[model samples]
Target: MRRVVQFSTGNVGRHSLAAIIGRPDLELVGVHAASDNKVGRDAAELCGLSEPTGVIATDDIDALIALQPDCVVYTALGETRPMEVIEEMAKLLAAGINVVGTSMVWLVTPRQADDWLRAPLEEACAAGNASLYVNGIDPGYSSDSAVFSALSLVTRARSVTVQEIFDYGNYDDYEYTGTAMGFGNSPDDPLPIAFQLGVITSVFGGLVRNIAAQLDVELDEVRERYEPWYTPERIECKMMTVEPGGLAAVRFAAEGVRSGEPVITVEHVNRLTSAAAPDWQVPPEGQLGVHKVIVEGEPRVEVNTLLSHPVLDVTEAGCLSTAARAVNAIDWVCRAPAGLIAADDIPPTEMIRGLMW
Candidate 1:
């Protein structure tokens, strides 16, 4: 069994930690939390597990490292000085401990960025002969596996477009409101628009570019558009914004030019409200959401798939499955060729199997 140390106790963090605790191949050696409220709490209880383990959460990184864990699973958010978290991961790697993280934008495509961000981590991992892999459900699976799955049916395709539509009102994270979904704000607010722009351009930019290259399309321009609106009346929800909902709908469309013409269009959207167009049907109950992939070519076809469970509730079985994907990738990530890797480079079937077991 591989000794593992987990950092953070947030939504994703808690789920990942639970997976680590249950996996026979993995032994949960330590748990770390930045928050004092959670410190000294049982790991299993914190994760809502039935049995209580003696392990108490700590904020001391050095103490956790002193346990000499073989790997560290870092799930801290990117907003809280994410670079610093990456730097610490580098330190752990340099100490000969393999690292797996979902903390930053690196999971999408680390190589695409300027070396200033990617180089140091690479150097540290090499020095310690350790490895790092980062991944998550949305950018990790939906954007890659779901898209690739769609591409399998097409014999010839001029372009591929993938779109995910879901209500953000279900998410339990409060930070998601103003920062991610733009709660309690007017449709014209620049903050929401800016947030959407940064997300699409930063996370999915590489996915779009990679798809273009796979299809042999030369990309000229990639753009993101945002549309936000407020409901004239209020809607009440336990986790989301107040009644009179604030909806921030964003469309991230990228145009890939081949032969001086737009050949490929990739787009994704996030809707903050429950209102769908009059012509469109509302999503069924317990439905996290739907994914549509359209191939534009001769006898153009569109395929729609649904995830039985949405990831809004971290404690749900579906959420565990998603989190386990990232967790099971740890060993492969440790053995992966140095540098940034994309999901297309990794096999999802194998990842899913490993996680399910």
Candidate 2:
């Protein structure tokens, strides 16, 4: 069995730990946590596992490294001090431990312009002959897997588009509330401008470019637009400042083209309140919400029009799926050709199947 160490005690780390512990092909060797409360707790209890092992969590990276596990799964937040986490992962890799994580923003090259993020990790992997892979549900699977799956049905295409809608009511993180949808007051707040721009230039940027490259469309410029919805009244939420009827809707549009011809158009929307907008649909009775993917082109296609599963819970499945995908790719990452890789580069079905065993 391949021995693995898990980092973090957050939702993602906890759920992933459960998945890893349940897998017969893998063994949970150790657990690491930054929280003082979590240290010295049994790994199984940390994940609510019925069978508790005597393994205690530790804050020391050296302690985890000393265990000499085959791999380490880093599920810390990529937005908060992500670079520092990457450095730590690099350290583990340099010690000959394969590193799989969700901290690196650019799972593949080109998504990021600076080499500072990937350089040290690559160098460490090369030095230790270890491998690293990063993935998540949004930028990882939703865009790549869902989009690729949609493309499978279409033989010809003039353009393609993918849309994701989620109700943000259940989430209560202050950081997510302020930055994710741009709801609070801050001098830096351009409403959703920054997020919209980043989506076009970062997450879906590479996908659009890759699509154009595949279609042989030598493009010119890519443009992005943002729309914010505010209620004449106010809506009260634990995380959001919006009163009864307030501004709780944000949409980002990205358009890619070649020589002024549009090749792909993508839109992402996040709504905090169900009644925030007329077009916005609330979760049906006994349902969480819906995640839909619609592709428009010469031979139009739509796959998973409305995905209503427990996996849509950002705190639960969102983070768990991301960490699980990254962990399952540990082997491929260990043997991957030196360089960055995208979601499309990794097979989702295979990754999921591997996690199940």
Candidate 3:
């Protein structure tokens, strides 16, 4: 069993902790809590488990490193604090601990990432002879593995696109849905942080670049666009309410252009309610969320993935998928060379070891 540590206990982090504790191949050694209230709490209390695992949560970084875990499942908040997350992962890598995480979307394809984001981690990996792998649902599986696998069935591929269609009504994080996503804000107001200059490109652009690299094509440039929709009437969600004319839905895309044409694209259609954006794309059969990958070629291919949980809604199931991707990568990452490992470096789905049911 590979000794492992789970960092953070938020929505995705909680799932990571639970998975680590439940998986027989991984031994849970420590938990890192981001907030003071979470500190000292049992791993069970934090992850909604019925039993205790004896592991307590801590905010102490050095203590976790001292445990000498083979890898750390990092699911901290990276959207807003990318630099800080990078530094934290560097410290862990430099301490000789491998890391597999859902943080740092750009790191999904580190070779294509800018120097500002990739250099430090490379140096840290060299210093301690460790590795780092990052992934999630959209920027994780849907964009990379699913797309590449689908392309394998095609004769001639012209373009590739990945779309994330989500209804944020069930998402409980108000700060994320309301503020970061601009759900409850006015349509005329400046774009939300998520849509601000270069944000979408920074997050989803890696997906575009990754496709280009796999196809062995050079991108002339990466471009982004954001479109927001307003609610006709007041719409109430679990997190917050959107008044008439408030931002209720958004459609954004980051395109990887080659020779002045977009050959690869990552798009997202996010709405607070089904009725909010009638004109934009919606999940098939009125589902809450679905990830779709389309490859335009002679033998056109399309794959749609819907995640569901026994007790959780589609939004939370999405989080579970994210955690599972990182947790499942623990063993593979531990055996890889010391560097930032991309999804292409890991074995295919069938070869990876874990629960089949």
Per-prediction TM-score, please?
Answer: 0.86, 0.85, 0.96
* Candidates 1 and 2 compared by lDDT, better number: 2
Q: List runs of model 1 lying over 4 Å from the truth.
A: 193-199, 243-245, 254-266, 276-286, 298-305, 309-321, 353-357
lDDT of 2 at 211: 57
Per-residue alpha-carbon lDDT of model 1 for 13-124, expressed as tens digits? 8889988888878889899988879989889988889887778899988899899987888877764475787688788888878877666754565556557667888888
The 10-residue segment with the lowest total lDDT in model 3: 348-357
Global Cα lDDT for candidate 1? 0.66
TM-score of 1: 0.86
Clashing pairs in 2: 219-258, 230-247, 231-246, 233-245, 234-243, 234-244, 234-245, 235-243, 235-244, 235-245
What RMSD does each model have against the real structure?
3.2, 3.3, 1.5
User: Which digits, one per residue and each the tens of the lDDT, describe model 2 over residues 125-196?
Assistant: 778877777766665565666666777787776667766666666666647444656664333445553465
Candidate ranking (lDDT, best to worst) = 3, 2, 1
In order, the Cα lDDT scores of the candidates are 0.66, 0.68, 0.89
